[model samples]
Target: MNYIIKIIFLFSICTLVVAEEAIFHKNLKIKKDDTTVNVKGGFKIIREQFYKNFKKENNLDYNFLEVTKKNPRHGDTALELTVGTGCIGSKADCKRSNFESKKRVEVSGRKIGKKDDNVWMSMSLLIPEDFKWGGRLTIQQWHNDIEVYEPMFETDIKNFVGLTMKNGSRKGYFVLDKPNKNCSAGSGDGSTGANFCIKSYQEFKLLNWDELLSLKGKWIDIIHNIKFNSDPNKGYFKIWINGDLKVDHKGQTIWKTHGDVEKYFGKNRWDFKFGIYTTSKMAFKLYFDEIWIKRSCKGLKLKRLGYKCKNLLDQEGGVKPYSIKDISGNPELAGTL
Candidate 1:
């Protein structure tokens, strides 16, 4: 029978190359002018930087970023962000709404510390249950490139940490942006005081939409522990999701130069973007995996990656509060939730 059908078609091509080498990993594929990638101590990451409305003549060639292995929440590959629907934004000159054009795919973090340092980041977010809710979504952000202005109370300083998600009536909340002191003055040109601070921790809710669709397909382990000071009693900003301890928070969190701290000194720091930045004309498919940054948790070795770093960080004092019914323990808290 033709040598038993060539041994069952080469054993079905060696079981599809061992199930695609157990979920893709040909050097962590991510190319499209790959900017950066190299993790595990020596640190480096600034990969897949698309967005300027996915430039290249707005052609969307990279097709909004991908490197999927299906459901990877840890290893083998996972970074699939898609934001389709007019995609315009290079300042959206030919606007079409969605707040005049905004839709993004991100991955930024290449060191921009200083001012008390102490950074730390970790990721693994997956929200696929057919995600599509009204507008305003900004997965994560700690941005502050510079916008200090008080050259005469024309007011436009800055201080705005981020992490948004919205959909009021049909219910879907997850917002955070704490730190308040919206500067209306100070810094006639000395920097660090056009402070348009922020404050919106939306109490945390899960009122409906079937408890926000029971948080779609799962995998949500996030962690961020910053400490860049603007001195709200020595700045702080802690967060941890899946493993609990939601938003420890303290103050300021960062935003110093805008005028002349020696002409923006090291030029204002803070940078750590995440995928999916939306104004939402509806269309998004997010998933990301084991993205990490370290400064501790033994520099995030995480017990050699098997993880059990005791809910992450606490090398003897500070950043406590673990399981309290799983992250902000939902059950109806309103606005900015």
Candidate 2:
């Protein structure tokens, strides 16, 4: 406990993914203010201070975000995020409703790090019993990007890397991209220049649906370990659900969108935000709570939610692969993995 294992991020990045079909809702009670009815008023001072710290350090606009007691993961309060349909009559000014608005209750942190750095985050998610449980919903994700102009194709290449989810069976995933040269360009200085292209790394599922669904109607704990701004061969990412390892990937975790990519090597920092994000036009509710970030595995409260995340950081070094240490009813092989 000597190390400060977690830090709270009160992010305020307004991201309204437009042109994409918006969300819809069902029998939920709607307040006179047009918001879906739920718990109100009951805020945690500790959580509020964390939010305030984020505002003071980053100074991002969080007008669309909310922190209330509508629901919580552990304490008397939690963060409730609702993604509403963009059109209902013609009130295009629904805070973040179409005609150019925001999406989800987004909160961004300061930055990932100054390249080749490791960052850890922990939180719990509660998918309300009434949540529209269908289709692919990106409840949470890793994202950071800055566009760059590529002269080779005479077009711009948005160099980006991050994780995404889909098809709603309550799943989480991460996709990898192999950095490869796209094409060669003629250099005015008489040297051939090359552009980069990323080959998709098939599809990597990080969350176990069965284990997650088993805890339905309750808060599910999660921990994300990220190696920031590392190139394809040097980066890594890991995720632990409750107390099980779901993703233990060791490869590039970040890349520059477009630039002299090499000059800023290891200087690029990443960011993250979680809430309801999906292409399905249905009503849904996503709740979040007890989110904290840390620099290493120094002081994270793994057993905070009744279950302990054993074998933590199994991929950091020479840890063995995941296996059933012992089989049930087999006393002979008990204590063996």
lDDT of each: 0.46, 0.41
lDDT of 2 by residue, 114-202 (tens): 44567776777776666545556556545432221111000000112112221110111111132212211111111322233222222
The positional error of residue 35 in candidate 2, measured at the CA in angstroms, is 26
TM for candidate 1 is: 0.27
Q: Which of the numbered candidates is closest to the native, going by highest TM-score?
A: 2
* Tens digits of lDDT, candidate 1, 1-337: 9999999999999766433311123223543232223333222222223233245556654345556667676556676666667553343322322223444555555545454677776666777877656555566566544433211000000112122221111111123242111231122322223333222222222112453357678776666667767655777666655655545655555544433533653345665556565555666777777766666655655443355566554433333322112223442232112
Q: What is the lDDT of residue 66 in candidate 1?
A: 55
Q: Where does the lowest 10-residue lDDT sum fall in candidate 2?
A: 150-159
Candidate 2: residue 12 Cα off by (Å): 28
Candidate 1 residue pairs that clash: 183-195, 192-256, 202-336, 202-337
Error of 1 at 134 (Å): 38
